[model samples]
Target: MKKEEVPQDESCFSDTEMKEVIYAVDKDGKYDKALSSGWETKTIVLDKSLEHIEERKAQAIANIKNGIQSPIAYFMEEHRMDIPTLASYVGIWQWRVKRHLKAKPFQRLSAKTLQRYAEVFEISVSELKHPKF
Candidate 1:
């Protein structure tokens, strides 16, 4: 059955709107101390099951989508993220990080780096590509 017709009441995210929990640091003192000293992230949950959700889910499971382009890459196919950010989290150089995000590392990967990312994220290589890898 199609997602919209699946009879599911709703999902915990939005289909039309995109949101990010930006942990920004304003060292320039742009605002009140309370606002500037901490993180600020935007989170949204949608309940509507759309036709594209299934495809996105599949890509996520297959780990072939893309990079850590955005935080919402956690839930949607179109939301696939870029490589630099994922590299930052993975502690690898951006280019090197791009090499191992396929849920399966190719010939250029090291067992140690792959294992570290897997342990830190608590997901198999396959699932790593599903998120903002």
Candidate 2:
């Protein structure tokens, strides 16, 4: 091996040392019990490599971010939406509705007050009074 390529005793780490690093422990420290370890040799099988999986994860995150930039993003940010009502009642918060009209091309709302706003927007009054998302 070349001079630079030569592995040093202090620098070189064994599987046990590698495991300690992965678990974020010291030389003689114990790894936390609450951790999962899967191996390629095990029953699980997929053609994709770890890099490919990470790339897909990054892409998915990008897509979610882009979705947030849309008119629908106004609704998500304006109020803490009820996950159950996602399919049933399509609604947005009072303040975000104005911003949506000014910036993003969206529908016109008729309500001026909070109660009227909820009724016009089709969201419950409870959701409007709760807090910003």
Candidate of highest lDDT: 1
Give the C-alpha lDDT of model 1. 0.43
> What's the TM-score of each model vs. the native?
0.35, 0.20
Maximum-TM-score candidate:
1
- Candidate 1 stretches greater than 4 Å from native: 1-57, 60-82, 102-108, 123-133
lDDT of each: 0.43, 0.38
Residue 81, model 2: lDDT of 36
Q: Compared to the true structure, candidate 2 yields what TM-score?
A: 0.20
Worst 10 residues of 2 by lDDT: 3-12
Clashes of each: 17, 0
For residue 132, give model 2's deviation from the true position in Å. 18
- How close to the true structure is residue 61 of candidate 1, measured as C-alpha lDDT? 49
